[model samples]
Target chain A: MYTRQNQKNLTSAQRKRFVAAVLELKRNGTYDEFVRTHDRYFVPDDEDGLRVGHMSPSFFPWHRRYLLDFERALRDLDPTVSVPYWDWTTDRSPASSLWGEDFMGGTGRGPDRKVDTGPFAHDRGNWEITVGVTEARYLTRNLGRPHKPITLPTAEELKWAIDEPAYDVSPWDSRASGSFRNKLEGWARNGAERWSNHNKVHQWIGGHMTGGTAPNDPVFWLHHAFVDLIWDRWQARHPGSGYLPAAPLDRWDRQRGRVLTRDDPMPPWNVTPAQLMSHKGIYRYEV
Target chain B: MRPYPTRCNPRTAAAVLTRRAVLRTVFTAGVVSATAAALAPVFRSRRTVAPAATPGPRPAPLFEETYRGRHISAAPAADGSRGGLDVRIDGRPLHVMRRADGSYLSGVNHFESFDSPLDLARAAVDELGSVRLAAAPAHHG
Candidate 1:
């Protein structure tokens, strides 16, 4: 569905139309106002009464609906416009022309911006080495299997690792929550040194689990696209992520908590991943 | 019958017909006069109208230096190094890096994911503290 090779290639006319569409939605009060109202999508169980693991199985569906709504807003503004996907895999190296000035703003040189050269060059003393460590440990123990500790790679290696398919790892496990909680506690009791180890682990698994919610980092989208691509690749490789049996208790439509039976209507809008993979049309990025 | 009708006929019919014609004329004149007065401003305004084609403000530069690649954009930071605060979203740590040119970049985990760099930065600032500018690394090839 992505037509353009690069966002820079988007015409001024297209950008104007897209902006107009988004503005129109905002003017009409049709835009998602959640950013103003809520702090985050999933509140940590420890901080808020909100249960961490209690997010509905329909989380994916809800996000899909939200994104489609935004896409519809864009389409309403200009029917010719399509949402562009970032292909991080092809532009694996930081030295490629892909990192040019017209693209990401910086001193106009180097992968990570030099501190003295441009705007926003400093470390925002705000980096909570502690929180970073704690989170890193939680993910490692839960999503990753026990292995010999690995060293954090250079920034270039980190970038390379994001797209490497050989690093594919499973994020969910049967005992993920407990393990995550235990790791959190261990990291908390320990000092910054303990946290540093967590940071290393964070970098390692982070490069592997390329698709999670980390949008602030420029690499987040590319990583996630690869992650999504991996899922697609997996289906192509293994046929499916496994299917839910057609049972009375299996609710395919999680929002409504309604069970999906064989006889039930499977509308195109509410297509299951299995159904999505089965369609003859599949998306692949043009390198 | 002819003698009785003769008394009521000619004089009264002539007077009534005259009054009706006068009233109709006056009413037509009043309506026409009012319409002309009402439309007078429109004609005056049209004559004083300014040129139809004035230039609009120039469009914003076609491309923002901040964004790189097809979907990539740089986040700005004060420190020489583009690195800013990092945060965890849905169990992932996002490194908020600023470019030397003053744009920003943060990692996104999915193709269809809706998180933006600004979103991630704001979250980091919210969780950690405001960003402090750091020294740019000495070795930038």
Candidate 2:
């Protein structure tokens, strides 16, 4: 089993190897497929269709598998390279080492929002937005969206989601309040803040990170690694609460075929949520 | 149901260019031209005119507006993702997806889902502010 470490803790060599492997994937076109898959799965519940990647109870497990598959892909290129998590709660600024010139690079500059700095910068010719299933042909970001500056999710905010006992509830989707899945997925739209936790981090990264085709930016892996880590933490906090909708939804329900129940097989992989409920042997997150 | 083309001139070419890009990625040039011809009526009002006589009451089009100086147009997504609307801000594409709860989301203001594509587009314009959107789109999916 491998352990996912925090980005801030990675040795310069480990970071270099990981970055190299990612660039390799981008060069050979495997990376674009990852972007495409994420875009394909970015279905919303209102579409009332096959929604697995987000806005549903499967948010945690689905991403767990997606991240795992991505890690495996990277390992194929370099066994020593493991995806590192970016703990937005701590290493939160655009200037952090996570965005250092030697690593993921800094935010977009100028009016076009082109990320001129970074290995993935368009001028670098290594990471063009090819299969993002998106419009931006080059990597772009507006860190903190300066005009409307938003911060990375705070530790306190994450605590609110991890503390929720129920893994998910009936009518399992973004609006399903009290469900740990939606809370951590950051779909709560009431009160002062409309976006929280996971969603807030994406918002703070703006540009390519702002939509379903977020993988266009390499930080997507680090950000999602942290999200996956949060899920692991949530699981440890509420061990008794398991994946929800233990059985399938009623046939009459509109979401019956769309939302994956505990045992339902997620498409593109056919793996059940129950099967991915644990990462004890597959991988572990280092705080 | 697929989204029809949104009304506007220059924006139509941008949307068409995006559609053409997606078609070239996934379909043949013949299909691309056919699609362009099909959508031609939306912008090419001089040709392919609609009938004066119609059926039952027509529903108000869901997306067609200029929010905060950014012109957004909605049409059926060429990729055929469910409830996926092919929207463009100014002359650049603004991809919008429908969530299970009937809200809208896009990469520009990606964190939260808005009530409709228009709301989502407006929020994206607000988030984008003065930054101009890069032209053209890709269909790597």
Per model, the share of native interface contacts recovered reads 0.07, 0.46
Residue A230 CA displacement from its true place in model 2, Å:
1.0
How displaced is residue A112 in candidate 2, in Å?
A: 1.0
TM-score of chain A of each: 0.40, 0.97
Q: In model 1, where do residues sit more than 4 Å from their true spots?
A: A1-40, A43-63, A90-227, A243-287, B1-141
- Weakest lDDT window of 10 consecutive positions for candidate 2 chain A: A128-137
Error of 1 at B13 (Å): 99
Top model by DockQ, which number? 2
lDDT by residue (tens digit), candidate 1, A76-144: 777765444334334334343323332321221222212221111223221111112112211111112
| lDDT of prediction 2 | 0.75
Error of 1 at A87 (Å): 2.6
Worst 10 residues of 1 chain B by lDDT: B132-141
